[model samples]
Target: MIIRIIDGITEFTGKLCAWTLFAVGFFITFEVLMRYVFNAPTIWVDEISRVLQVWVVYLGAAYVLKHREMVTIDVLLSNPNSVWRRLAETLAIIVLFIFAGTACYFGFQLWLKATMAGHTTDTYLAPPKMITHAPVWVGSALLMLQGAAQLYRVWAEPLPSDDVMGGAH
Candidate 1:
């Protein structure tokens, strides 16, 4: 049940990230049209699009991890029959937990600091820094959650034959 919930959340976030591509295209097109046709380039468009891109990339990472789509060099763990495969997989998950966990912790701190400090961009939009930092914190938190789910599966559930190397056969 918990895994399903995490998977659902990951899927939903992935979809949201996918939609940002359209937003990015729209923003770029609008900026170009306004700049060339009216000689009025908006100051906010570039920054807004950049932020959207960052959100898409970061949020999409958890989805990738959830689906086991991220790249992995598994040459040493290729032997499906080897007992060390599980150990290697567990080690990899530990590394993920450490990295994602640290990112989540620090990202939240950064977000909180920016929010409390009333930090804003110097640009005309002057959007709060939280607008930019929120995604990092949220995405890293999601990644950590997904990693926890993966770790649970690794230890508690029986492994599928195809997933012997921590990925699809």
Candidate 2:
């Protein structure tokens, strides 16, 4: 039940991240056109695009993990039926959980500090630093939540017999 909610969020977040990537590309293109063609470059596009790029990475991390797309020892889980595959997935989840949790903790602290200090970027736009720092904790939390769902999935399913991962039976 809870796992379903996490999966739902992960799917939604993935789509959102995809759109964000598009936006990042669009923003960069717009900046390029403005600078090269019109001889005028906006100050905000560089920073905005950079922030969007970072957000895509941080927010998409959980989606990556949920789909088993992150870096891994493909050979270990390649069989998809061996007990070692499940064990490897579990270990990977555990490691991601730890890393995400730690990132969330420190990210939240840093975000709070930036907020309390009323810090802003040094650029002309000078957006609040909290706006940039927010993705760290938010995305880490999502990754941790999705890790739990993946952990559940790894244990609940039975091993396949017919070589579902494209290898011989």
Candidate 3:
């Protein structure tokens, strides 16, 4: 039940991030056309698009982790029943938990500091830095949650066979 909920959240967020890519492209293309053809350049395009790109990448991280789509050297862990494979997988999950948890902790701290200090971007639009960093905190938190779910799944469920890939049989 918990895993299903997490999977649903990750899937939804991934779709949203995928849509943002289109927005980024549209903004860039519009900005270019406006600048060259119409001789009018908007100040917000570059900054906004950059911010959106950052969000798309960072926010998509949890989706990537949840789906086990991240790059891995799986040559040695081909056999699911091997003791070495289980050990390696356990170690990797532990590392992911630690990394994601630490990032969430520190990212929240930095975001808090930025919020308290009233830090804003130097651009004319001057959006708060905390707003920008929110995605980092969110992504890290989601990663941590997903990592815990994955750990639970590995321990509670049967291991996949060599033919299975990315949680698919």
Candidate 4:
């Protein structure tokens, strides 16, 4: 029940954040066209696109994991129903748990500091630093949740199942 809830949340967050890639691409293209054709460069495009990319990475991490699309060595995972595959999966989950915990802790502290001071970006628009920093902690926490669920799944579920993702074409 709880794992399903966590998975549902992960799916929602991942898909929503994944769409930001389109926004990033559109913004960059708009900037290029404005700079070349219109000859009037916009100041916000670069920063906005960069921010969107950061979000896509930070927010979409758990989605990548949930879909089993993360970068892997694949030496052990290639052959299922083996000790090596389970070992690799356990190690990966432990590493991810530690990383997500540390990131969430530090990211929260930094975000708190920035928010308390009412900090803003150094860009021309000077958007709030909280906007970017907030997602770091938020997304890290979500990733941690999904990691726990994945860890449970690794042990609880039967192995040797065919694992194919959405874009398997």
RMSD vs true structure, all candidates: 3.2, 3.1, 2.6, 2.6
Look at candidate 1 and tell me the lDDT of residue 140: 83
What tens digits encode model 2's per-residue C-alpha lDDT throughout 76-134? Answer: 46777577888977898898888999999999999999999999999989999999999
lDDT of 4 by residue, 35-117 (tens): 99999999999888887878878889988888777876664467655677877888999999899999999999999999999
The lDDT per prediction is: 0.83, 0.86, 0.83, 0.84
Clashes of each: 0, 0, 0, 0
- Give the per-residue lDDT of model 3 (tens digit) for 1-169: 8889998888899999999999989999999999999999999999998888888887898888777777667687887767787777788988988887888888899999999999999999899998898877888888877877877767777666545455652
Candidate 1 — what's its lDDT? 0.83
Candidate 2 wrongly placed segments (more than 4 Å): 159-169
**Best model number under lDDT:** 2
Q: On lDDT, who's better, 2 or 3? A: 2
Please say which candidate is ahead in lDDT: 3 or 4: 4
Task: Name the regions of candidate 3 deviating beyond 4 angstroms.
Answer: 159-169
The candidates, ranked best first by TM-score, are 2, 3, 4, 1
List pairs with backbone clashes in candidate 1.
none
The ten-residue window of minimal lDDT in model 1 covers 160-169
Q: Whole-model lDDT for model 4 versus the true structure?
A: 0.84
- Model 1 agreement with the true structure over 25-143: per-residue lDDT tens digits: 99999999999999999898999999999898779988988777767666777654456867777788889878878888898999999999999988888999999998887998888
In candidate 4, which residue pairs clash? none
What lDDT score is found at residue 85 in candidate 3?
A: 75
Q: After superposition, how far is residue 62 of candidate 1 from its true place, in Å?
A: 0.7
**Local error of candidate 4 at 26, Å?**
1.1
